[model samples]
Target chain A: MQFERAVSVEHVQKNYGKFRAVDDLTFEVHGGEIFAMLGPNGSGKTTTIRMILDILKPDTGQIRVLGGPLTEATKMRIGYLPEERGLYRNVPVLDVMIYLGRLKGLSGDEARQRSLALLQQLELDEFSRKKVSELSKGMQQKVQFAVTVLHQPDLIIIDEPFSGLDPVNTLVIKRLLTDLRSRGCAIIMSTHQMQQVEEMADRLLMISNGQQKLYGSVQDIREQFALHAIIVEGQGDWGKLPGVVSVEPAANGNGHGADRALLRLDDQTAPGDVLAAIAASGDMHVRRFEEAVPGLNDIFIQVAEGAH
Target chain B: MKHLWIVARREYLTNLRRPSFLFAAFGVPLFMVGLMFLVTTLISNAEGDLDSLGNIGYVDRAGVIAAADAPFVPYADEAGAQQALQDGTIGAYFVLPADYVDSGEVTITSREGAPDSLKEAIDHLLLANLTPQAGDDALASRLEDPVTLTVRALDRGRDLEEDAAIGVIMLPVVFAVVFFISAQTTSSYLMSSVVEEKTNRMIEILITSVTPLELLFGKIVGLGVLGLTQLSIWLIAGALLLQSGQGVPALSGIELPLDLIVISLVYFLLAYLLFAAVMAGIGAVSNSEQESRQLAGVFTFVSVFPFFFFTTFLLNPNSPISVALTLFPLTAPLTSIIRLSLGALPVWQFVASLLLLGLTAALVIWMSARVFRWSLLLYGKRPTPRELWRVIRGTPMTAVGTAAQE
Candidate 1:
């Protein structure tokens, strides 16, 4: 179901009276990619998502969803999981799913079959006849995610996909999203949960107060904001090493490596040179050694606060 | 169009099973039929009045009676007649005034009420007093107490069937009641359905799948069909009642113009379109059920505003207020149906009312679609009238300060 281009928003601006909700924003999501939209609470990420889904119209720009404007026919090819997600609480789970799937242009049998399969995959088949309100929050979140992808939409936009999920369920959803992406789906996911974005998103965009603060591939953006430092875990006297200006505990989590440390280099030092020096030091045996790059969480915090 | 149909089907099916819809659909016809049976049974029983008024007492203020008889007991004064009435000497009394011969006016009072026997005795007494040959005149008059009522239509050159005339007059009232109840029930269902979707945040999910226009029309058409289902049941019940009610004399006779039922149905559609559109807009703009009701109340007030002046329309049919309500889309359905039922409304008023009602309903639906689209995603405090107006005017009101589900 790959289209020419999944979505292209050009110079989009949306305002509610004097307050600009989005301003001159431009971006595109192509097939077979996960684009993370990172922002704090009320940071226009949801607004931007709605704009792309054609739920909200941009004031002064053109948004071509699924190659052209988001028409009734094209709307079927897109899916959305809003932050304030909901299903018909009183309706049976499978019925609700089928209704939504049918609304998205799926045939009844196709929707029912797909819904049952998704429910089974998510281990929710037993609750298919139960009311949605009867499900636990985590279970409901899984159901919501299932509903989003039930129609196999070409362009999927999800907000806070893993907000209230346990690690196991989160992994399940993450894998599902990844699988969708592998099948040439263009997914735009918005969240403040930076770890998931770093793990799953190929490229990311950060918006605050309706303006784009950052937009690039996950690795390139991380490296762009990377510090001139290396992290060394295991037994090491890293503070006394040559070209080492300082030594401190790693604020960013470095996993279960023994005795972790983040080594800051001087202005004239190279990260490769520092790593070579660490290896030459006979006094140290390192478990993990890598150049330091700031996580998306820190960058998100910095950008959101800076915008304020 | 397919999406619209899907949405409509979902709405229709989902609400069809609602308790309120079921009750309105089935309960109303049963209730109306039961009421008709009860009322007609009582009216038929009432026609069997008591045969005698027992020992008639008269004040005889005119002193016209020469002497008292067994049935006729003359009292000297008004006090005597009252005393006699209280003492159980008489079951009822009548006062023939002092100028009885000249004016020929007689008044009667009875605790047993004026039964036919007492009334006929008085007629005899009057004929005997006024005529010298009292016995023959009284006997001749008593054989037949003559009066008759007959309705004839000169245009058709035939006497009206008593049942059909009654039916013609009663059709509008029946229609008005059913329509008023059904419209309020179904339109509110549409409103609350919209509000529920908004409250549960399901609008966001639906808006993505279908256009707002599709969403609005789907719901209106779906619930309109629901209303029609209810009306169909009532119509069947009504036909059953009309067929059976002809045998019950108190139900009288009915002659309904086929055009009346057809016109009522036409007005029902127009009324529903206007009402459902307004209600859908209210639901979209409101954040809660109470808010939806509060906003919906404005239309309720407008629709019923004509009722206060209903008599004016019935009397004049061309009064300003009457014409205004007949043309006003919200008030037109019941107003026109009722007035048209009474007699022929002028052709111009009928045509203009239909045209205006239809045009206004169409216009309101257009505005409601705009309002529905703009307001479905909005949350927090309800939007003000001015804000709603701006949205209706095609201004994009992005929900900025409010949480746009962020």
Candidate 2:
């Protein structure tokens, strides 16, 4: 059985005077799924997120988080890490975290306990007493992320979570997200990091120019971009297959006796048919034949470029 | 309520931790105290020369006026007095002509004209020595039946000595100085903090954690409490200095009513809130320090204008201008406290003034809350008063959500 919908947006539209920020947006974040909203800059990803948070009301359509109108109580169940990270600069890391936790209705002692635990998990326990400005940019961002999830909200929303982190910190946060997902938190992240989306996102929503261009499971989106390509380790004359559209030598090039070829299929042909046909060429030694699914980056570029 | 306290505690802690806040709280007061000490010492040590000092000689025609009882120096005759004065033996010579008691006129002979002080002393002496039989009705009334209005305050908690009066007079000035400093410094703190956060895009994290109202209230409460702490230290220092009698008179005899203290505290609280709210409103709309200062200028004026009315309030605390000033929330905290510290205020008037001030404070706070909610989201551009009013009327609901998260 499917888990309940943690967040649902039904044809929501937001307009700032004459400028439409989000237009006819509709999506759902299912429980325990890592749903990523993928978009280029100014594609209304933040705007849609704001609408979901009830920070900005939709001009049209409806939004429900956990099956009801958004209130302060509902907000307590949702953890948000905005694209622009901030804390009171003069306030210490621990104090700001506990203070944020308190807003979600955690008592001081409870907030302190949870915040310290989070800081430890983020490997920032040593600098908890330092002011936000005293910390390095990446360190402050980690502290901000810690504050966001200290209350362990059922739905976690992070915008541009890896915008400024070094590779190590990015891996740390990606691991944290994975851990959170395992514990049954519904994570909705918005980012231009297609690599992250490809690796972490289970479902994806692609928006272009304030309008929804694509929304589905990551596999489904890749399937929708049916420009099929396959990598084959066969030796000779693979480009001679009847339905093969194009052939490119793999990065190892043809110099190595053990080489691979990327075969593209025509619109009407299937990668399986091409693989079968290539296998019939006994002149080629076949070691591997695997169809390459479209990556999130490829899907994003294709959909966004398709829209414009 | 718990959330409010959490917010308030956060505000207080953050504010207390700020280097600028710490500096203003301790540095400004200590500087003022040092400056005042230096001023008092300078004035007390001011020197005078022979030219600046006054001297006089008396010629007593009436044998009744013995030489021992002479007001100034005694000379045998008018020529001798004139010769002595011209020869620099005296500053001025007084001629007590015949029937000087009845005439109440005394001639003075000198090379140079007597100064105002000597003239005043000569008149005083002539008046003091005059007989009662020769007294006019005004003189007899002034001497025989002086109207003595003894002050008896209803609530006698602390004595109001002359030094207390001095402190009382100084109270308005002190609070005015503090209000001035606080309004300038605190509002800038509020403004700069807001602007810096907005510019740096740090407000986004804050918005997720706290409501705009909570943030505004927290900041005001924190800064106001801090301001009061500084003020209390200054007041205690002042009280101690007066009591020590290093040169200033000690507080003695006059009592401070419980009602006055209560009213003063309440007024200060309300006034601080009013100012704080206005500053928050300014901070919300401000994208820069220069813009914040310009926006908060009106509040600064309201906070400091009471000092200009200090003279009038002292002369007649119950006068129409004083009454109006004391009833105004911005001025009431300082002016009303000054009035209460001095004698002769009716309880009802004090209560009425406080009530008015409280009501005004409430009104300003409510209005400021509306403005703050609307403006806090707007960044890179300041909202106009008209736009703020529109937000209050709910015309621009969309704008409310666009607040600067920082």
* TM-score of each candidate structure, all chains considered together: 0.81, 0.78
Ten contiguous residues minimizing lDDT sum, candidate 2 chain B: B248-257
Model 2: how far is B31 from its true place, Å? 6.1
**Candidate 1 lDDT, B1-406, residue by residue in tens:** 8887888898889888898778877887788789888988765555444234468888877767765457788877778888888888787788888888788787877777786656766777666665555446545464555533355432222243444545545666777868776777789999998999988988878888887788888899898988888888888788788788876754546645577778888888888888998888888878899978987898888887766775686456677788788877788887887777666367787889899989988998899888887777777767778877877777745453245644
Residue B264, model 1: Cα distance from true site in angstroms: 0.8
lDDT of 2: 0.71
Number of clashing residue pairs, candidate 1 = 5
Tens digits of per-residue lDDT for model 1, A60-121: 99999887988878888888898877878888899999999999888999999999999999
Which residue pairs overlap in candidate 1's backbone? B163-B253, B163-B254, B164-B254, B164-B255, B167-B254
TM-scores, chain A, per candidate: 0.93, 0.90
After superposition, the stretches of candidate 1 with alpha carbons farther than 4 Å from their true spots are A3-5, A15-18, A59-62, A251-258, A267-281, B37-170, B305-324, B395-406
Best by lDDT: 1
Residue A13 C-alpha lDDT in model 2: 85
Which predicted model would earn the best DockQ? 1
lDDT over C-alpha atoms for residue A169 of model 2: 97
